[model samples]
Target: MRYLIMAEGEGDGELLLGRCAAVEGLFTDPPPPPREVLVLRGCAPGVRAEWLGAASVVGRTESGFEVWWTLVDAEVLSVAPHTGNPALVDVTIGAGVLPDDWHRHADGPFVRFELTTGRGAVRAVTRSATDGLVADRAAAEPLPLRLVGCEPAEPMRAALRKRRGRHPGYTELWSLDDTGRVMDRRAIGFDAEWTRPSVLGGALVDVLLSVDADGLPGLAARPAWRLWRAGPPQRAGSWRELDAAGRHAWLMLAMRRERPAGPDRSGGEYHLAGAGLRDEPGLHCAIGEALLGPGGYYGWGWDALFDSLCGGFGLVPPFTLVWHDFAATERELAGEHDPAAGPGYPEELARELEERGVTVLRA
Candidate 1:
């Protein structure tokens, strides 16, 4: 039998019927196809639809209307009502914390409650009833995947340079040893047309790769422009609207989302659609790993040999960069090196990171 909840106050009768029981209740006939109605004295607008399906909701209206509703499982006032089955709850709370009066039974870490028990009983009833429907639907496509600790090498540098022009105020140069280790690690040392080096570490000879920016933000912003010229434009974010922090946030979220598979053989192992990195022919680079911290997140691109180093090191690597500024620390450069910069704790830091499954490539 259906449970009809008639409000003792104004508006709640219509409001409850409008919200919980119907999808198009606002304008439907016969009060929007009644399922089970629970009338109350007062009303609460915040009480959601899911809550209605499970158990009673405590709510009040602006005019001092208050009410709660629950399906009836037992006999009530000579009325045909759906029996409101009592709920049972068993929860684990932290030790040493004072037990709240809301729980009926609290022994050690576990607390148990029956639906007809008291106040919490109704909430528990509603929660259990709606759990399946609410939990089944997945959340929105996650924030995009982000590339962290991205360093530009020869191919990326040449690719952007060929796509754009000689960028001033930017430096892009780096080297990888025969074993894929970054060698004589230093930020790129050069003068492009549109940028200038605010800081300098001089240039290295055996440059395996280089890029204009020391961090991923700069790399991400410029790629869109280059990609457009390379062929039909792809869907990379824009440069003009986003700054370093904004770019980093956007890229990090973007990289984590699932996208179509990459056409290239090298990046095809992970189901591209199921993978975080967006798969597009125009993708100029791949993020190998990422780090997160209070300052924020940063991304990095790795070379072809990067996969090997990660694999050899027994790492499931997060994003592409060999190194990164995951916490957004304001250092001289993104991943700048200083042999004599004083060993505050570089060796220890490196060891800790490696132990945590990171392949810390030395500069």
Candidate 2:
């Protein structure tokens, strides 16, 4: 049987499966997944995971034939399955949740199996993993995430409050040429994206897809968390305070006004894939980081390089740079301009982001 694995783009599309190959007994010893599984790109070839080392298989797991990659564009992923129609199987992959073959990793594995199929020939199955593969990188502690049932806007509201009480309050309005706009704001919730500053000129913060050596999945869950200096903050409960929203809002707003909204804003469906900032190449566009405008803006200082790689890797379509918001404040600014800025930032931080490989728009 020919198994088809569909994805937004052909290049990086295989990453989802590649990770599955990394496990010790997965693709090799025990033949982790059925060796017959096939993979394909669901979107246009020119527009896939061409950057951010899209082809790199950074992490893997044993139990579910399940794998991991950097946060994937949940929006693009929604349509990907339909585009290629993984003939015998119709499984959906996205953020936070595990795929069919995950339970094998459990200490006290559950007992249940689910399989189904739509119009396609392949079958979609969800079951408990009896024998799972274990990859070296899949070692990060399971995320200690808490879900809150509330309007997405509420997190941003709380983030703003935190930013207000913090130092270097939101007083100025930084602008990106036309790409987007941002302001001084912050909030906290489940994801780092809660109360995220305006991004892609109000397009909304799109979840970033990433996989690191730590074996943890990272996303811009909340806009508020986008500006956090550390990983997901430590807040417990449905209604609690998060952290600062960061300081790129004003700079972002300045950029948005300079440009117009993007073309692929909507697919006219209630499902999220069609609305807000569409994927572009060589540029990582986020909603609240005051990042990326009509051309491209640099608001997600940390995500800048990764996004660039995402764009370059073809996960997103190609775009141009219209503006770059350069601001770190008087005291926040690096003491001196070390030509080797990229090297200074930790490798685990953004990897080779600052190296000469990427293109940054200078003020």
Candidate 3:
């Protein structure tokens, strides 16, 4: 959900990444943030240096107990003999360390680290790998993607030219909703380039960002801006006019809620009109309208919905939510996310409301 890029946090940055189909890493799960190396003394002999692939290694106890480690997705550096004691091998890792799983493979070696379990005392001479520990590998470089468009902002253009491609450094970017609400912001590292905009038909999009990552936030599914650009919905059941994708876009906008300027509007007997309920998004749209008139946002998704029940969203808890025609609404939202297990969405929501001190009347 990229709005025209705004410099810093406000005003136009005068750049358009555009609503292109999902870009790898750009929208989806971004790579984990870069981290420092974590060292674990008394990595224990139970760690199988033989299992050490070209990338990483892990230590374990005989019973297969888990490690006291943090970084699980780590790169294996080497599996050479301990410099001090040639008999004992050391498995040096980088980027991250072993996983701290509650239970590991029963047959695998029980793993432990000195930082947590070891407590600074030397446990014992570690067990030896049947095959000697002997693996050394250099880290692979991150592959950068190329961007071609009407050039980036002044500062971004300069950075691209200066770096020419390697380690150009990172910058913070924000994901905006249709209403220009900041959904989320992330500091991403990118290697940019100056290239002719790829022309298809008669459209042009600015492209000046590229980076490698595992799982960062933002860059969610693109929205159909036409809905909000015409202005916020004013009539009830406005969500019914759009197709499923548009309705989902509406719910997403609700999820990226605008911070209420004043105190929240809580405590009410909100009446929900279920006449237009045909899908999950319709339910959320109706709820928002029921809570705070048309085009209002209470919350979207389970966690956000629960938080909305607490307070701050347009309408809050300690109120009565009279859901009319709920039977039809339930049918529309039945067996969602999973038809095989758990109650229907309506019941789930009712339970959540009841727990939060909201009275739910289903009709």
The top-ranked prediction according to lDDT is: 3
lDDT of each: 0.26, 0.25, 0.52
Off by over 4 Å in 3: 1-153, 163-189, 196-208, 211-223, 243-245, 337-342
Candidate 3 per-residue lDDT, tens place, 1-363, comes to 343233332354333322321223444444443544433333345434222211323356667554333343444455565656765656554553322233343355544433211111122233443222222222323443333233245555455456463233334445554555555444545455543344432344345455444324323333423445445556677667775656766776555545557876667688988766776667777888888776777765556678776666666667899989988887876533244345677778788788888998987
Q: Which residues of candidate 1, in runs, are more than 4 Å off?
A: 1-242, 259-330, 333-352
**CA RMSD for every model?**
27.6, 23.2, 13.0
Alpha-carbon deviation at 98 in model 1, angstroms: 30
Ranking by TM-score: 3, 2, 1
Candidate 1 lDDT over residue span 1-363, tens digit each: 011111123443221110011011111111111233222211112222232222333223334443332232211111122234322222211111111232222223211211221212232222222111111122222111111222334433443354342323333222222333222122332322221121222331111122322222233434332322232213322322444433343344333323334332111121101122222111112222222211111222223223433443222434222433322221322132333343322343345446544455442
Question: What is the TM-score of each predicted model, taking all chains together?
Answer: 0.18, 0.19, 0.51
Candidate 2, 223-299: lDDT as tens digits = 33232213222231111122212123222322232334444231111111112221221112232222322223443
lDDT of 1 at 141: 21
Rank candidates, lDDT, best first.
3, 1, 2
Location of the lowest summed lDDT over 10 successive residues in candidate 2:
17-26
Off by more than 4 A, model 2: 1-317, 324-331, 335-359
